[model samples]
Target: DAGVTQSPTHLIKTRGQQVTLRCSPKSGHDTVSWYQQALGQGPQFIFQYYEEEERQRGNFPDRFSGHQFPNYSSELNVNALLLGDSALYLCASSLALELRGYTFGSGTRLTVV
Candidate 1:
């Protein structure tokens, strides 16, 4: 089965632009988490979603936003992008309260010029 799926594996945008990254969770999973991974660094939690609501968030600014659909798919939206926003955006899926582990997608590589 498809663990998770993210579109536009690679993307290029200019500063001040906005981008939306999409993710489809694995079958039977009701929770989704978004992460940002920079070069030479570990992934940083961005947010988590369950029941189409944002249940938790990290230290990111308001420019980072997300939405989870009833189908358990999700989207990460970044507005007024900055160069620092360039990174590997990861999408992970899991069952709420299960907590065993999460299935991650290949990720989308966003580059801000």
Candidate 2:
């Protein structure tokens, strides 16, 4: 089965610019979660999507939003990005309603210039 995958293994953007990162969940999975990993810090939960609806969200600003598709893939969008937004954007996938450990993709590294 195919595992999670993320695009633009690395990204570079200017401050105030908007960016969208994409993710494809593992085969047979129905839930996707996004995380932000800052240098020297653990991955912080950004949000989670299940059943095509957001199930949980963290303390991020309105600029952070996401979408899940019928295929179980998802996308994360950040508007008016800030320099602080520079970090590794990780995508994890799991079976429906399963609190088990997640399988993470390499992630899209966002570098706000």
State which candidate has the highest TM-score. Answer: 1
Off by over 4 Å in 2: none
- Single out the weakest 10-residue window by summed lDDT for candidate 2: 94-103
Residue-by-residue lDDT tens digits, candidate 2, 1-113: 66999998999999999999999999888899999999999999999999999999998998999999999999999999999999999999999768466889999999998
- Pairs that collide in candidate 1 are none
State the TM-score for model 1: 0.98
For model 2, give the RMSD to the true fold: 0.8
List TM-scores for all candidates, in order: 0.98, 0.97
Model 2 gets an lDDT of: 0.94
Residue 64 CA error for candidate 2 (Å)? 0.3
82-110, model 1: which lDDT tens digit per residue? 99999999999999988457999999999
Give candidate 1 regions above 4 Å deviation.
Answer: none
